[model samples]
Target: MFTGIVEELGSVVAVEDRGLDARVRVRGPLVTSDAHLGDSIAVDGVCLTVAELPGDGTFAADVMPESLRRTALGALRAGVPVNLERALAVGGRYGGHVVQGHVDGVGTILRRTPGERWDEVEIGLPATLARYVAEKGAIAVSGVSLTVTHVSDDAFGVSLIPTTLAHTTLGGLVVGDAVNLEVDVLAKYAERLLGAVAR
Candidate 1:
């Protein structure tokens, strides 16, 4: 599990394809300092296991086809920046909301409205995941947890402070850019429980 707090803005070093699976190497000194084989790292919100500690501030993880199809990682190329987050340690300070590093769906940036103190970004919402998103709710976008400032049937908006804009990759987002979205898991669980009760 993770807290959806991005630790570093890492870049893809290499991508080696192996038919249905691909090996990815990302360079992140902070996340790699204590990383070990089998450790979990959230890359752009997708939880990937560390297959090898390359000892050069980089780690390799094999991305299965299922993961490739479900997230934006598959389309990434060398030099592309990605949000990196280490798995939450036991008793660690919970800075952000609970994040499972599972991408529910991919969304596209529809527009960005600049404000005096912050920026408001509107993102296209997937129909299947739309019902789970609510105004003022927590949502993870590309591994950075943020609050939903506004929500519509077709899209949602998030306000990004200057700190988030400077520290994370979200600062460079533009219209038509794709992002991984993970809605609040608590909402999903509640829906399941209500459905069971109704039945």
Candidate 2:
């Protein structure tokens, strides 16, 4: 599991395809500093296992077909910046909400409104995932945990502070850019239990 707190802004160094599967190598000096094989890392809100530590401040992970189909990681190529976070340790400070790194769906940046202190980004919400989002709720966008500022039937908004703009890849987002979205896991669990009880 992860906390949706981006540890480093890593770049994709290489992507090698092996028929139905592919291997991705990302350069993350901080996250790979003490990394070993088989460790879990969240890459753009997708949990991927570290298949190899290449000993060059980079680690490689194999992306299965399912992960490629579900998240934005499949469209990634060399030089794309991705949010990287190591798996949460037991005693680490939980600054963000619980993040399973399981992306619910992909959303597109519809527009961006710049403010004096922050920016409001509106993302096109997928119909199937709309029920999981709520105003003032937590959502992971490309692995960065953010609070929803507003929600409409087809879209939702998030406010990005100065720190977030400077530190994460979100600042570079443009209109029509695709992003990974992960709704709060707690919300999903609650819905599941409620449905079971109703039945």
Each model's TM-score?
0.98, 0.98
TM-score of 2: 0.98
Best by lDDT: 1
Off by over 4 Å in 1: none
Q: Which ten residues in a row have the lowest lDDT in candidate 1?
A: 67-76
TM-score of 1: 0.98
User: Against the true structure, candidate 1 has what lDDT?
Assistant: 0.94
How much is 196 displaced in model 1, in angstroms?
Answer: 1.1
- The digit string of per-residue lDDT tens for model 1 on 102-193 reads 89999999999999978999999788898999999999999999999989897999999998999888999999999999999999999999
Quote the positional error of residue 20 for candidate 2 in Å.
Answer: 2.1
Residue pairs in steric clash, candidate 2? none
Lowest summed lDDT over 10 consecutive residues: which window, candidate 2? 66-75
